[model samples]
Target: MFYNREIYKILPEKAEEFCDFFEQYIMPVQIKNGSKLVGKWLTESRDEVMVIWEYPSIEEYRKIIERVSNDQIGRKHQEQLKKNQPYLIKTEQFLTKRDKPERSNQNITVSGYIVNDVGEMLLVRTYWRSDTWELPGGGVEDGETLDHALCREIFEETGIIVKLFGITGVYSNGETIAIIFRGKRTGGELRTSEETKEVGFFPVDPVNLSTYVKRGKFIPRVLDAMNGQYIPYEAFQVRPYKLVKRYDGEI
Candidate 1:
């Protein structure tokens, strides 16, 4: 349920004064009230500033913004801003959340950790998982073998017809299965489909991978593959994972 907002403000000539005020008074109050200032940048002209905010939920974001708006210190800061440079203009806002998990009666899924000749790995932004990125591949379709499914998913997602060089790892927990494959791009033009919005190769340490992987759940497997350590198939089938309940009886 995480959310984000991008705020763009155009200010007057005394932008340094506003920046100082923001850093000193506004940012502290926002953080204190539970809104994280994810990123911020200002122009040399001192006429505009762009800021990004992250919050667990819209309600939480509103609570923090309201608290800032109503604070005595915040009011004083706003007054000073108005007097010094009143041309502040807010441009837009954006909000997003994690994509819903894909469900299927058939439990097996075939995923790939495709690597290019330069050692970069491939990732995709799927239409189904809008605003989030993922390793390229998807469900094992009916009558499709695992290797075939892997090839099909890669082509469908990234338009790269590939030969499945080998299996990187296999993951299963009785209810779901994830078979990771390593492949070399064979032949095909990069194209888009209804399911994929974009696809490209990225270095193992991708700069923006956090937007897709909210937790560390799928990271270790990718890391292992990137390090040339192949995960044993038996390990996937043997790990014992169970759900636990807290003392309050809520899962």
Candidate 2:
């Protein structure tokens, strides 16, 4: 499906009036022209309104636009919009193709298990949780490869350079997928960033580590690397917004 996401940055106090105008004057005309009203939402601050319209394809979206341009009721709606323009500060629209329903809800995270020359594993204490020691990693940013994100996150949290060895494992918990990679410390000194309060190498075995490190979620991944077990990374070809190709290989 094709989506027309309309974002309106309106005067803070005029959000309700803008939404009322959309419902009464704009929605009916768009609906009559082969568009489905996906939903409308107001921001918590009451300063922005968002409306979503769906079409089967870009061609259908174009047809709807043409129909709305020619229809008498749509023309009247445009006139009303001019009179209410003062309420709207700015408007932005985005054309996007919707992904498959099954794949749309998944979130991806990348992590690195970097072991130093002394066999101690690198760990960090995040600013948000100074008491809990966790592996250095973060969510994959848009358009960034998993390995790149892993390296970037490791560097951001712990001031060190790492060379990725291979995939450690892929873990899933509900709607989230975590890709852990085995890495070796290559350069840089032990340091901390704004996001991290502490950065250092600790004993890999949970029995030899502090309580916080022993109870952290990355212990399993650390143990797996020490045992020389690595899962084959899966490669994917994302076409537009959907996964078009997937194969067993390094990502």
Candidate 3:
């Protein structure tokens, strides 16, 4: 287990604003990424605030931090901090470890890289991610298989039914695990859904990938799918169990 003892010194007049900012921009994201708040305290003068966070492991702590910094909401949080710097005087942190603590549930997501015979990859632009085109996908519904979830998401977002090649890559960032699959469109017309603003196929040019995908974390997933390298992935049952299926060798 690891703990983060975070101390924030702020102007007494800015205390309310700081607390609001923390609650609105920071606390939810941290909790969503598997960090737990042990407690929060305010000093006698009310100029200093103390927060303790518990994590199952140091590695998990690092992943939560990294994910918060890379994701869209995290980016917004950073900008808010810079924009509201006057509320903070100084920040201090302490990291220490002991026995591992209980961990929160992790969110699982699936995405697909659907390429056409002509070499262009299917991509979508959402309202939140309008800056760069990204693969179409979403959170896995409870009890759904990864491959099935990906197929359903693709159809919902881009109206495309796909012939999956296999698992192209897997990624983990503390609280979330994303499985990326490689495939090509088998049928269905291109149409935008409520979650997507635009949907179409675009050329996958390595030299110009950055122009299409500006998000650092998303670029590698696209690149891996483009290269055609695959990881053998399978899902199985445990209890009154069975071998559900596998997504491999099709690439």
Candidate 4:
């Protein structure tokens, strides 16, 4: 979850008019895309307007923003901005992550960190998460080992069979826990799956990662996997009391 706040400083006695203009042009499109308005407030002097919005996740927020800024909707928003110039004095905004609560019944997910022979990293864009490109992987199925899950997901999403080396990082929000694995592409051709709209390798530029992965919570995971230390991972069967395999990891 995430929050977005907009602060608008308007000319004296213009708060109501500004709010009305915003409600007509911007709020509807945002709501249609699953953004919720937390509340709207005015200063004691009634010269400033402040509104807070909530979104289910950063990726959803990104998709909503893109929807609101493109085609006819974007033109409408721009027109409103021009009209508000008479009353608008200044504007400010910031985005923040929601506080995570204690976990219960969290869903486990897996993602793969794969690089190609020429140093391009694999990424995929899905129809649902269309606004940004993300690492190729998905939810772990029951009865599947972590390594097997990562390999299968990578193949299913990007048509690339991978040789996973080690665990890159373990991350959790209140609702979901995600484990990332580091590996290199071993075989198969690049192609998109039904779940993926676009799939390919892209250059990993520190200055440009945000262009592809706009979600705040996701960028760090990619960076940590790309530059951080790798940890050993193993699969074993408790009933048989036997170790199936182990990954020594690469630096």
Candidate 5:
């Protein structure tokens, strides 16, 4: 997607008049000329307004500009804008190219740590990997939120309904990004799904964990949850074939 961001700085007293002009005349004309209005926002101080217009691509944006230039309705709107020039102070615009949608090579997983009243943690042993026990979770489906995916996966694997508390930890191993959440059992009986060979809550201790959990990181994660230690969310920016930047949120 391509975006044209227009920033209008106006006199504080004329803010309402400018917004009225935009809604009554400018917006309709722009929409009719193939411009998609993404949104319009007012800054906290109310002295500035920002309008985001979207187009499929730079080519489409150029076409819209050309069409609007010759459009009769657009010309009329421009004339009206001149008549209300006192309400407008200054305007600035810039074009931005949005990242294209593409198939991702990275894998995202959402897992839950559901502790019962007795402090036992939920564990699952999959039929395909019966030698190692792990948290009841799975890959996130397309268009599914992290919380929804965690709830669905936990219920599917262990037949337990849980209320998520918050994020416990986020771990990335180059290719896979795993988001672990803390939760408590709300209701439901312990029943194994077709993919799971066993589902039950076990004592939340490192000794008991080492005997059942296969992943080495699971022990420390469990200990962290017991100690109430949490890592904040982190966002990353990646180029098509390269890593670009990573931003970590305050804990």
Candidate 6:
């Protein structure tokens, strides 16, 4: 895990000067404290500049802040700044560990309701099960965050990187926790994932509805998430209790 921060400013010319100071002074401090300089950029408008940095240890960020507060160069930079507010921001102390990342215990399954502007849901006929249309999403990985994984999955499954809005509902089926995040169509050529045979968006059509529900199971809860005004829950079972079957048949 890493601690990251962004500093935004309005002056483009000052951005170069700031980057110079950061590279010459701040970056050395960061390297000494075991941190990496991620990115530093000035926008095309020449009015906005942004800087990002990451630290393997949150303690490193704290130490940098402490050193910045006491350093003569830091004080001089502060006095030289024309902006009234902070052109340089400080983190209010945060901790992170790779073995157990922040929000590692947050029970979440990365899933999304792929919907178009007309409220139609995007469904994929997956090769994994058969001819059926289901919303694109899957289980979150152990080392990945829910939001990031969901976005990647949606792109991989539907060939579209939809902008995920806010959390619509949290669904749990006792076995798995599903985080239903809202989404809108961005821009991407439609394609199918390895699990999906056919992928496209369709309205609430009943003719194709039969294919979605197999073995008397309704999967429309994914759509309920996009309709808005759906009830939010921390945990929910989309299906009833079931027992697993073991086969002793010949291999």
- Best-to-worst lDDT order: 3, 4, 5, 2, 1, 6
Task: Name the TM-score of candidate 5.
Answer: 0.51
Candidate with the greatest lDDT versus the true structure:
3
Model 2 misplacement above 4 A = 1-103, 214-216, 234-251
Task: Write the residue-wise lDDT of candidate 4 on 164-237 in tens digits.
Answer: 88888999986678899888999999998656779999998778999999778878889988885688888998
- Model 5 lDDT-worst window of ten: 242-251
RMSD of each: 16.5, 15.0, 8.6, 12.3, 18.1, 17.5
Whole-model Cα lDDT per candidate? Answer: 0.64, 0.73, 0.81, 0.78, 0.74, 0.58
How many clashing residue pairs appear in each of the predictions shown? 0, 0, 1, 0, 0, 2
- Model 3 residue 42 distance off true place after TM-score fit, in angstroms: 43
Worst 10 residues of 2 by lDDT: 242-251
Instruction: Evaluate model 6: give its lDDT.
Output: 0.58
lDDT score, residue 220, model 6?
54
Stretches > 4 Å off in candidate 5 = 1-100, 231-251
Per-model TM-score versus the true fold: 0.46, 0.52, 0.58, 0.59, 0.51, 0.45
Write one digit per residue (lDDT tens) for candidate 1, span 145-246.
677777887887678987665566677765567778666676787776645667787765644556554446577557655555443222112247543211
- Candidate 3 wrongly placed segments (more than 4 Å): 1-103
Measured with C-alpha atoms, the lDDT of residue 7 in candidate 4 is: 83
Pitting candidate 4 against candidate 6, the one with the higher lDDT is 4
Candidate with the larger lDDT of 1 and 2: 2
TM-score (C-alpha) between model 3 and the true structure: 0.58
Query: Candidate 5 overall Cα lDDT vs. reference?
Result: 0.74
Model 3, 69-94: lDDT tens per residue? 87576789889888767767546576
Instruction: List, residue by residue over 1-251, the lDDT tens digit for candidate 2.
Output: 56788887788788777877887878877765556788988999998888888765566577678878876778998888778777775565756653534234455788887888887889888644456787888767556778888889898778899988678688886556888888789998888874676889987575665564645566676666566566655434555565433323232
